[model samples]
Structure formats: structure tokens, C-alpha cells
Target: MSVTVERAVCATPSTQRSLLPVVGSGTQVPLVDGTSRVYANLDYAASAPALDAVAARVTEVLPLYASVHRGAGYLSQVSTALYEASRQTIARFVGARPEDVAIITRNTTDSLNLLARIVPTGPDGSPGRVLVLDLEHHANLLPWVQGSGHRTTILPIGPTVAATLQSLAAELSAWQYTLVAVTGASNVTGEGLPVADVVALAHTAGARVVVDGAQLVPHRGFSLTATDADYVAFSGHKTYAPFGAGALVGRRDWLDDGTPYLAGGGAVRDVRTDRTLWQPAPARHEAGSPNVIGAIALAEACAVLAALPDGALAAHELALRTRLVAGLEGIAGVEVLRIWPDSTEPVGVVTFTVEGHDPGLVAAYLAAEHGIGVRDGRFCAHPLLVRLGAPGGAIRASVGVGTPGEAVDRLLIALADYLTTGPLARYVVEDGCWVVADDTRPLIPVHGLDGLAATAAACGPTVEAASGSCRPRRAAHTAA
Candidate 1:
């Protein structure tokens, strides 16, 4: 699906507004040339700006926030009802099966880790083998390594998406794996996986499939029943809500039969010195006061996204992706990265490398000169980055409903300027980072965190301020 959007050749915040309303969309930031510009946030894949609706939802929930479960107070009962209702909303957002249970989690990583810790042993009484592609993000790949009854067989990605599917089929036929875990989309290149087909392959081979939907849920329509995947995990931060809430929606059998993710408070039905009886499924997994407001906000985000006119969001983002990719490719020194030649654009995450510029420096220059926020590093998919021949790192510009066309145009212009005439401001290495010399931009004061902003400013160009993705300096390996 694609939508026709007017293209702009020059950079300006007034060009066009977002398709969906979001907080901090028109916020201005100080640039190095004693001028300020509207902050163009092109790093949606990392953490999307909060949707206006989600913030409102949070505000509404905060007053109702009281102790969850076992409370006689009116507010407590209301909060408990809201928490469980939010779970149902989350489940419905992904088109979960009636038997599926949505467990509240911190993020996708925490969800995956929880499942990993509880996987049941196979009939052979050993941790069975799991099949996975090399292209998955660390959140998807690393969790399997720690699964109690599973060891992963990392399959090398093929030359094409078709070949990769065939390879997965072959791998499944050759081995009796217990599970097949895969990413819904490649976080590094935005290449979506054929999840329905993958689910079919895995189920045909008698293995359950887990689709990491951290990247997919934010951009496209996802239905677990349509795909027939046994499980799917996602985070609210990537789904247009703020951080602190995520979900693991999947079959109830495994979660009910397995060990509880946590063993405190609401998790147990009866507790004594000698014995304990754990609750089932969601109650078994969730065992604390919980993030009442975060869950409500996340549910609000999901409801809002699910109610959009069919294909509206997908069309808007893919259109932006096409324009951004073409513009970047048109540059002389910029090389847009892709995993499969035949893979169509799934979301708007696009990574590229400049011929003669350090990724960190390029990101810093963009922040200092253009007020554009982009990410530059391995993106926590170190394995994928290494395979793409960008072990050092690369620049990534991801878009969402909050992004305007002018932001994309601005990024292209900034990159072209850097490639052609170099950075407008002088730069020198400070604290092992390439920072604008004598950057005079005053740090914004964050309430209650007195001197924290200034302290960060004193430390020249922290990773979040410059690259927002500078990773540990080390050899590329099979590690997060």
C-alpha cells in the first residue's frame, strides 16, 4: 500500500504535519550556528514519540492508580479492573486467540527472557534444538540461548527472501526442533519476514513459532490468528507509547504449565512454609503491583492503532520509506544497506554509511547543524551489522506517523552537505568522541534532576546526544 505525498527538496518544519498527532512533534532544539530549528526526530525505531492520545490516557489512569487486586477501596477495584482490561485490549490488538494470554512486561527483551526461562523440556528429556535466522535482532536471538529446554541452530540468511524460506523449510525437515523463533521484521534493514509462511513451516514440522513483533507492530497490521504464530512479543515504547510497558501474547498451555516468571505477591494462590500453589498463565507470570499507568497508556496506543482505517498507517510509512531510500541512494557517497534484494520494504528503518565520515561524527554533525536526530551504530543487532560489512556501525533514519516529509528532505541535505563541503562547524575529539568544538548550546533543564543536564553537557557529547547508538568497542561476535 502506498500514499502520494508531496515531496520537498528543501528542509523546513512547516512543510507538513504528521498523519497522526504526537507529542513533541514541533519542539525546537538549539543548533550550533547560534540558531535553533524544530527537532526532526527520525529515530522512531529506537523509541517513538508519545502519541497525544497515549499521554491523555496516562493522565486519566494516574488518578485511578491504586493498589491492584485484593483491595476493598473503590480506587483499588477500579485500578485492578483497568489493569486486567488493558491486558485484554493488548491481546485484541494483535488478534490473539481466545486461549492466548497477554503478560505485562517491561519490554520485548523481558518478555522473551521470561518465555526462555520457562520452556518445557522435550519428550527426549533434553533441551531441544531451536531454529532461527542470523538476521534477527538481539532481543529475539539472545533469549533463545537462555531458554531452559532449547538450544538455537543459527541458520545463515540466503541470497534472497525466497531462498531463506526454503532454507528454513529444509532446516526444519532435517531436524526435529522444539521451536522456531524469528523476527517479524529486520530492525536493521526494515525487511519484514513472511510470518504466516514461517508459522506454517514451523507448525508443519511440529514446532511452535515465536514472532518478535517489536518492530512490526508499530508500522503494519499484525494478527496472530492470521499468521498462526504461537507467540508474539512487542514493546509499547516502539508502538507510539512511552517506555515501561510491553507484552507477551501467546498460547496459555506453556505459560500455565511452566514455572512462574516471578514468585511473589499475586502469583500464588496459597503460601506456607512448606508449600505453595501458583496461579495460572498471566497471574503466574505477573507478580507485582505492576505499571498501572504504563499498561493503560500502552493499551490506549494499541486501541488507537488498531482503529485506524485499513492500510492507512502502512501506506503512509512505506511511502516515506520509498522517498527516503531513493533520496539517500541518489547521494554520491551514501550507501543504503539491505539484507535481501527481493525483500520489500516492511517499515521505514533505513541504514546507510557515508564514504568518508565516521557514523558518530555524521550523527553529531546532523544534531549540531540541522537539529535532526538520527541513530548511528550497530543498532544492537551486532550480528546483522557485522554481516552487512558495517562492523564499525552505520547511520540509521527511521520514520513513523510523527515524521513529516520535510524531515526526510532535511536529512538528505545535511548528508550531502557533509559529503561535499564537510561539517559547517569545527570538530575535535573530546572524551573519545568527535564533538563540535566549544559547543555553546545550553542544556535543557529537566525538573527534579538539578545540574544533571549541565553535568552531561560538561561530559563532551554523550552517546545519546551525539550518536544515540554508540556501542561497546569490540570485535563483532554472537553477543548482544
Candidate 2:
């Protein structure tokens, strides 16, 4: 991976403050004189910082990084053993049997796409009728919808289980579907789903089920065995192992019957000049050089998570989520966009909009002014965001395993600042959108990543104080 994507794997503010080695030491310095900008990284739903344990393990194994499967050297054999062992770790982490296949891929999107490619086609040679909810991330929705030439039936879900089940049952009874794909949690709202019911209903229609756990796996605990999903997929980046890795854990039979997701290399058991024999399920989907480092990091992350007591993590996350939502709700001009009725149990994420400002502008201002990195836009779940009346997107503030109460407070303060002064209008005239101090820039010596450095550089001249005259100068260029 390039430095840009690799940089995303670096430590979060919480981690930086803790035992983990902060990636951008110079960047961590605050822009303001007295204030060390405590980073409120409310984008865990997109990606999470690696746990200290995961990082330590990765460090321990870095020197051991070598080609897996069939390598002549001692390190290669060790690496191969570690690689296969990591799969078992993931299987056990998700409560899967030893024989269950766990194929590592680029991310949750890649995992779902792999599953979509490998699922058996129906008697008609298509994917057959497919069932999915409107609540799905595009990763979960599109793969099944487009990959299959089959008819698709969408299930509608809202805040309540009663309403969701009614609509879901109605649709399932109507279609000759072969598969049902549901997100175990909504990335936008952080809402946990009633996946067990979904699985039960889908099976009645003779359809296998796939759970998109990209969002669910990080914040909430899950059991693949308990859910009994035919397949469970998640991104490792979201699981605090942001090394461009993810997994799709599921049964063997369906995958074994279909064509592999990719061709060549490790996917083949043996290849003749004219004819090639494919490997078994997991190996079949993993072609070319596997992401050895990524897989190691992810396995370490899962192990760390598994070691934690069950309710401790969930309780901690829920407490943060509650704090975030309550804090956001108290702010004027802030509309807490929920999954509706507001009673739904969600993870440590809350997405909403400001009455007058654009979600993108709010997110940008938060990052630029507060050193708070939150996400804005559809978050790749455009359909759901659109339905929620955020046609563009909603500002997303997600808490992670390392997130703390103080960071949430900082985010609230930033939001309050925006509500009063309005979003930084992007274009300031003489000293427009001034960055009095932006430590995330290379010139400043603190900000490390090119994306962050570029962002910091783009922000203009810094003035300790601006008079009304300077403010008026900024206002002149404002469009009607």
C-alpha cells in the first residue's frame, strides 16, 4: 500500500496519548498556544486505531514477515504457520468451527464482493432472487444486487423490530430468493440489528444469509455461531487493524461449489500448461501474494478484542455513544438524525446535521479548527442517508475502543463554536479561514501524513486575532 493508505493505519489521538507510539509526533502539538488539541477521532465506523496490544504484536512479528504457504526458508515456514494460525484465531474469535473457511481480503467491501462472486447460482444460472434491507451499506447491497443476474427484493427496516419484521416477512414470502444480505449494524446510525430474526426469516424462504459486520464487529461483540449466518464479513481496519485487511467467515459447501473470486497464484492447488485445479474454499478466494502484514495485524486485533471481558467493551462503547448523542442533542441548530423514534439501541456512533451549514463544511471545520477528525457525507451508505433526508450526507461522529469522554466533550465544544460563528466559509479574503497554528502540516513539523499535510497547507495565513475589518474583508467574497 502507498503511504497515504498506510498512514490511515497509524495511531489515533487516544492511542497517541497512551502507550502506542504516535505516528506524527510533531503534528500532535496543538495549533493554539495553551491548548493541546485533544483529537476526537469520531470516525471509528470508517476505520479504528489499532489497540496497543495489536500494535505490539505486529512489532514483535515484523521481522518475521515472509511469504506464506510454500517457502523454502525457515522464516517462510514460520510465516506460513502464522498465516494459517491467524485464520484459526479469527474463526475462534467469531465462534466458528475449525473447518469453517475464513478468507482475508482487502476490506469488508472486498470480502462481500468475494462472497458474491462465489455464491452458487440457482437452477436458472443466476444468483436467484435475493433479499436485502434498505439499511445495508452499499458494500453489502450492491455486491449481491449487481453480482447476481437474479431478481432482487429489498426489505425495509426502520426503528422498530415489529415494523421491520412485517416488511421483511412480506417480501421474503413473495420472492424465490437464494440469498439474504443484511448489515449486522448500520454504519450511519450505529444501530444494532436483529440479525437472528433476519436469518430465521430468510431461511424460511430457502435463502442463505450473509451478515455485513463491518460496523458491528468493532464496537459490539458478535458470535457467528449464535447468529448462524451462512456468511459473516467485516473489515479489519474497522476492527482496529487498519492495514488493508478484512475477512469473510462462513460455511464451506457453498463457496467450494463456485468459481474462485480471483484466479492464479495461491488460489490454485496445481496448474497445468492448459488446465488448472483450484484450491479449497479459503485459498480459492485468496490469489496472488496475500496481505501477510495486514492479516497479522488483523489477527492481533481480534485476539486483543477477544481477550477483553464481554460486557466491558460494550458498556464502555455504549456509555460513549450515550454521551455523544446527548451532547449533540443539547446543541442548538443541531439535528440529531437517528434511525427514527430514537429508542433503537445503537453503537458508539451518532450522525446528524446542522440546520444551516452543510455536513461537509461542519466536518471540515471540526478537523481544521479542533483537530477533531469526524466524517461527513453519505459514508458510502447513500441510500440510507437519502432516506433520512440528508440528501448529501450527515456529519458522523463515531467513538472507538480507545475513545474517551474528554474527546467527546471537545467535539461538542467544536460543534457549539460552529453553531454560533457559522462554518468556516472555506474562502476567507485577505486572511481567509486562517489557521493560526496547524500542527498537522510538515512545515509545522507536527502533521505527518501527506493528506493531512496537504490539508493543513491549503489552509491560509494565521493571525492571532482578527478585527471586525478583517472579518468584513472575508465577507466581501461571500456568494448570495
Best by lDDT, which number? 1
lDDT of 1 by residue, 177-287 (tens): 888889998788889668999999999999999889999988986899999999999999999988599999999998998889888998999999999999998989889
Clashing pairs in 1: none
What is the C-alpha local distance difference test score of candidate 1? 0.83
**Worst window of 10 by summed lDDT in candidate 2:** 1-10
Q: In model 2, where do residues sit more than 4 Å from their true spots?
A: 1-36, 124-126, 421-480
Number of the predicted model whose TM-score against the real structure is largest: 1
Model 1 regions lying over 4 Å from their true place: 1-16, 147-149, 452-480
Error of 2 at 271 (Å): 1.9
* RMSD per model, one decimal: 5.3, 8.5
Model 1: residue 371 alpha-carbon error in angstroms = 0.4
The alpha-carbon root-mean-square deviation between model 2 and the true structure, to one decimal in Å, is 8.5
lDDT of each: 0.83, 0.72
